[model samples]
Target: MRPDAVVIGVGNPYRRDDGVGPAVVARLRAAGLPGVTLAESDGEACALILLWQQRRLAVLVDAVRIRPPHPGQVHRLVTAWPVPGPLEPDRGSSSTHTVALGDAVRLAGELGRLPARMLVFAIEAADLGYGAGLSPAVERAADKVAAEVAAEVRTWATATADQGP
Candidate 1:
């Protein structure tokens, strides 16, 4: 059976703050929201597309490296399905992924494989250096972001249920 929604965590845990995505996923896993699938990706475009295909909603959590670094700031963005056009990566921030999330969204749009709705939660990073754990600020942000994602999933589920079969 298809899940009502999927959350994709895009980042490398070994890369310090880049691990925020996986960190958020771990929290959601513990919350155990029904009918919501959770996945971790290296932020590769194809892998991301596959994770979200056919779902009603997709929520992506990732890390963004911005100049002069804010460490733990979170940014939320929603992309309309059948995306109007190719999305440019967030201004002043670069993805920690090999392929930017915007690129994946564009590819999915072109392939006609986008989910009905998509959300991105990008956390600013203080460090992308080789390391096994997130920096202190990013860790705190992870907790906050996890709660936010859980709330979003619950909201989506409620709305979906209200729509009826």
Candidate 2:
């Protein structure tokens, strides 16, 4: 069976600041939040669709490249849409991969595999170089995003419990 909610951290740990998503997941897991299923992905769209199928809620954390260069900025948005194409595109993505997070979400929507409520926590990355560690800015943002995502998980869990079986 699917989880009450899933926290998906999407990133490539080998690629410096691109690892923000996985970092966030690490923090969340360390804190041991209840009733939350945590997952890590390479930010692939089709794989994301598989991770979030038939869930009450899904929260995705990833890094994005923003204009004006607000590194470590956290952008949280809703994504449980019935239609496709509303998600932002990856034309400006910093991932080494061609398929970006927004593109992945849209593709999942097109396939009708979205959960009841999906939240996206996209962090503005400071660097995407081939490295082992995240930039200081991105690391700070990861901590912040993890806390926010954890709170959202708790909220979802409480709501589900209230609904009853």
Top candidate, metric lDDT: 1
Query: What TM-score should be assigned to candidate 1?
Result: 0.93
Task: Please give the clash total of every predicted structure, in order.
Answer: 0, 0
Per-residue alpha-carbon lDDT of candidate 1 for residues 1-165, written as tens digits (9 for 90 to 100): 888699988899999998899999999999888889999999889889999989889999999987767889888889975556434334566777667788789888889889889998889998889988988899999999999999999998998899998
Report the Cα lDDT for candidate 1: 0.87
Off by over 4 Å in 2: 82-86, 89-96
Off by over 4 Å in 1: 81-89
Query: Compared with the true structure, what per-residue lDDT tens digits does model 2 show for residues 8-78?
Result: 88889998988888899999999998777899999777888888888878888887876656788777878
The residue pairs that clash in candidate 2, if any, are: none
Computed on alpha carbons, the lDDT of every model, listed in order, comes to 0.87, 0.79
